[model samples]
Target: MFSIVEAIRQRATPQAVALVQKDRTLSYESLFQQCDALAAMIQQHVPHDPARVDRLRIGVHFPSSLDYVPLALATLAAGACFVPIPDELADEEKRDLATRTGMDAVLVLETLAGWLPEGTQKLGAFSVAEQKVLIQRLPAVTPGFPAAAFEGINPAFIRFSSGTTGKSKGVLLSHESLLERITAANEGLRIGPGDRVLWVLPMAHHFAVSIVLYLYHGATTIIEETHMGEDLLRAGAEQKATVMYGSPVHYRQLVEAPPVGEWTTLRLAVATAAALDAATAEKFRARFGRDLVQGLGIIELGLPVLNLTGAQEAPEAIGLPLSAYECLLKDDTGREPPAGEPGEICLRGKGMFDAYLDPWMPRAEALDAEGWFTTGDLGRRDAAGRVTICGRKKTLINVGGMKVFPEEVERVLDSHPKVQRSLVEARLHPLYGEVPIVRYIASPEGAPTTMELRNHCRAHLAGYKIPLLFSAVPQLPLTASGKLKRA
Candidate 1:
């Protein structure tokens, strides 16, 4: 795999559309120039430690824009670790990220300049009257100077986990590991220069970076700042996006909207971060005339595995392992489970992260000697070698000694015609010890009764697996990555 900077330089072209946001479109050359300027400016203002000046840590808080991409690339060019703070994060959370990462400085768009925490220097997008004096007082970099040389093992990014279960942890990625994961995903998706990708997912997520692999192929990337259903559809149609990547929540919204008909330029769509239910998958095909490609990914590992092209035949399966990864299902005894038996899903991959940052503190843990990282997911492999995820190991419910997967009940509930959305959580039951309680959102005009949903579940799941209690909510809580919060 090529270094990210080298890949960008080689693939640069005049006609390539590097970014397409709401008001403007930028060419690859323009984007490159901006990155170069940003890199030079960053090098000038940020004070470098004598011993570690070659490597800096910069926190960036900005909306998705053509400018933001270059700022990120520029940070990497300067041999610095780029930490992206999501725009949706609370002020306290944003400050915590900066303090926790030991950021030497922060980069922000002009609008967000006031949100910077105290005791940190803020670099505005452009020089201003108030900021000019400070900008002038800093050291300057020579124009057109080359970026600092970095080894493949150098830290490129410090990405925070979604923190749905708890506080987010920072997962460090080296250039080699990041590149390997991009290569694996590119190979699995068969991404190429001709592909025009619409990027609507949050850029802070690892899966979003998967789209960067397209740069190596000289592909155009259309950025949608908002994940609103209308914005996604309009961008796809107007930009003629050939490929799109998003979460299941995004797909559900698109399908539920009024008819948009078939998208002529669309060739493939990838959905991750959450389970792509069969009903939702079918709705996507019916609305767009294309199957929403589903894959498995974890913050601990990049795109280590993906389903094959025709693997949508079993939409529930996570498909085959990529060349760089080996996946297995292990029983409680640590032995591989036989086909058709459920076990813990474990992965071994070249693209896997070196360690997981401690959520409560700053330390990390390396992988065990076995090389496999337990995914905390329960799954089973079929005779054909395809894997189907049952549910999260910790989220499983035990009902009077019978094992129950809340996801199974939730899927059944979501499949109901009147159900808009649903979530299944385990609750303590006096008689059963623990049982599944489902919280759902229903269509405003056509809501179904709890007994009706219970009957619906009976058709697909065993009695013990069905939710014993049901409640309605206006909307479900979601994490920063856009996945539903199970707890």
Candidate 2:
């Protein structure tokens, strides 16, 4: 029965600064009041009658802002499951999510009111005075609604998967499960009342484990809405931010930008949502004197692995499992793979997600018989039990009888001084079944010729792993979360 709202209340009574933006600061008391006010407004739309036919499902569509925190907490406090519809998504995708979740209502910024579907009632409006945000709501659609399967599970939030390769699924988490995840993640993060987290990732995608972890542990969170490196560095230094969570793209920008000031208070810079390239890690450490610790974050699991110890020594290793989880690598037949042999990464953890919202894909059907969730990632553990992720099992390239991972080749291309970023993919070849091709963004100075790139790869990789062709692109496609999207 651990409540996230109650935890925030206990910490905010001290009147500390809980959240910070450029010029906006939200004290704990102000944050609590906003959450309370929003909760009351939400209760007006949801029926409290015990005999109600379905549980309330509320969708939140807003940009990354300080107001987002209170609205989400308020939704949960009002006994409605919170589903975030990112503003970057296309209108059709947003509507599809709302329809699939059977959302009972939606809360959006006043400026975006016209985006809601037609034939929906305008319930009412509310203002968050502290953040100066006006919000409106619309009623849900009842298109042959099924019995509310979610009420039985009592989910606190429903998050969609990254959908890099296929349609996304809704991953459910209860209040208790969220608490467990924060507690477990903090065991490694070691956050406290004095620490401040510099956050730049999209709130819609990363709020659950990251923002919640800082709040639960009484840490301040400095929100930077823009991806501009100067803004991020200024806030981190001025606010004396102790920790930072960003993707590899953000880290690269930080490395390339000129120094703002000495970040004496910053201790940890975590890179998640995608693989960490060795080149990025080296440049970041060389410039800032801090290792960019690579971590693995899955929708089904909060954060099971982090490279805390080996960031400088083994920049590519995802490190060992967190204290609260057990991890192993298994071959396709469910047999344990030998040490250093690549296999699918499987994990069982206390903070694992509860269910999938799709009725056709139940939780039991998704997990294995042993209760271990088989992550589609492919990795191998060294003698010291450190795991290095090679690539996704679904994305493996087969050439002749050998298996080649694109990441293995992409790392080489990224290491080139003239290459900014690179993506590797498979192409059909009548002779070898399939061969790898490299698509890259070259540095403004000049890019090496294709033959030079191939020779560089030949020096580092086996002949089968060397890419057959190299093509220059303005930029490779990336998901909203900043993970490289391979097609």
Candidate 3:
């Protein structure tokens, strides 16, 4: 029942830098004031009755910035559930998501005019809106639309799953669950008031766990405009950043950038969103004089597993499960597998999600009878209890930290008039750990060119979801049951 708002309200270090953008710095006192103002305004739009406050579902759509920090805190401070919507999503997708999630309204930027569907009513473009927060209502609610089940749990946040197989569902988390995960994760991160985190991850995708951990622990968060190597290095040096969390793509850019000044302030660098190859790790170590820590982050679970010690030598190993968490590798029969034997990764920890937002799909289904959540990733445990991820039960391709599902891409490719059948698989990339390479069988009369297929995919899918290479095959490999055989 305890929310993070209480922690923000008790700002022990009032004058300390809480949030930092390129040239702007917001002190803890200022952040607290802004959150209070925003929360007060938000409360005006909701039912005055305190009992009805927690039922409001508000969507936050924006890029990462200093301003976004308070808006998110304010949403929770108002006793409402915050749903993060990525900025790059197509408008059609946004409308559909709003409908599926039964969102009451979306808080967007003023520049993003015409975001809602035609004829949708525009409400409070609040005069007190500091971060350009505009709320827009949907046209009409569907009859008997199921409301999210938050009967016993205090739902605080909802985020979309990676949608590796098909449509993405909402993963719901409560304040207590989030607080538990962040507290558990920080046993390894060790962030505090003296530490400054150089943040480059998008707010929509990662803010809940990472940024909240930094703020909750009284760490300064530094945000830069661009992820370019020069800018990142400059910001780290200027801001005295002690910790940095980014993707492989961001690290690759830093590794390729010319050596600026020695990064003496940086103590820990965490790599998430993709696999870290030996070459990239070596180059980063040579450049920064520090090993890149690989982390396993899931929406349902908080940061439970991280590679802290093995990053320098065995970068492939995902290290041991962090403190306050339990992990298991089980075989098909649900028995613990032998050491070094590959099995599905299962976890038992404090920060488990509250529920899936899809009203029909209960949260109980995701957890086993014994309360362990089976992460679909296949891995092996060593004698030291270290984990090495071998493959995934789900075929979600990590294209430079963006999750791209082959089924989603194949659906677009199969819809092409000149395409008969299609298959999508991961191809190794030096920079991006893996990219989707597509193989398709075209119609006999006129085979579509690779460019044509790429264009077709681009129209329907996100840019990262577009296939890097395309091949026209006489026929696609099929299994005995006639399903497309994936390598």
Give the Cα error of residue 197 in candidate 1, in Å: 0.7
- Give the top-scoring candidate (TM-score): 2
Candidate 1's residue-wise lDDT over 26-47, tens digit each? 7888777777877788787775
Model 1, position 125, has a per-residue lDDT of: 48
Model 2 ranges with Cα > 4 A deviation? 46-50, 129-148, 414-422, 438-452, 471-482
> Which digits, one per residue and each the tens of the lDDT, describe model 2 over residues 412-462?
888898898998999999999999988999999988898889889989999
Clashes of each: 0, 0, 0
Model 1 spans > 4 angstroms off: 1-3, 113-115, 123-153, 206-208, 225-234, 255-262, 286-289, 359-365, 416-421, 429-432, 440-450, 471-478
Residue 266 of model 1: what lDDT? 92
Q: Each prediction's Cα lDDT score?
A: 0.71, 0.81, 0.79
Candidate 3 lDDT over 1-487, as tens digits, reads: 5777776567448888899987788998999898888788777764334554237777777667898888888888887778887776667777767777667767778776456877666677763325455767666555122443463577788787654444556788888888898999999999989999999988988989998898888999999889999888888888889999998778888888866756789999998866566677888898889998888877888888999978876786788889878888887789988998777899888888877766545567778998888887878888777897766667767778766667667868977999988888998899999899998898877899888887888888888889888888889866321346565
- Give the candidate order by descending lDDT: 2, 3, 1
Candidate 1 at 420: error in angstroms? 4.7
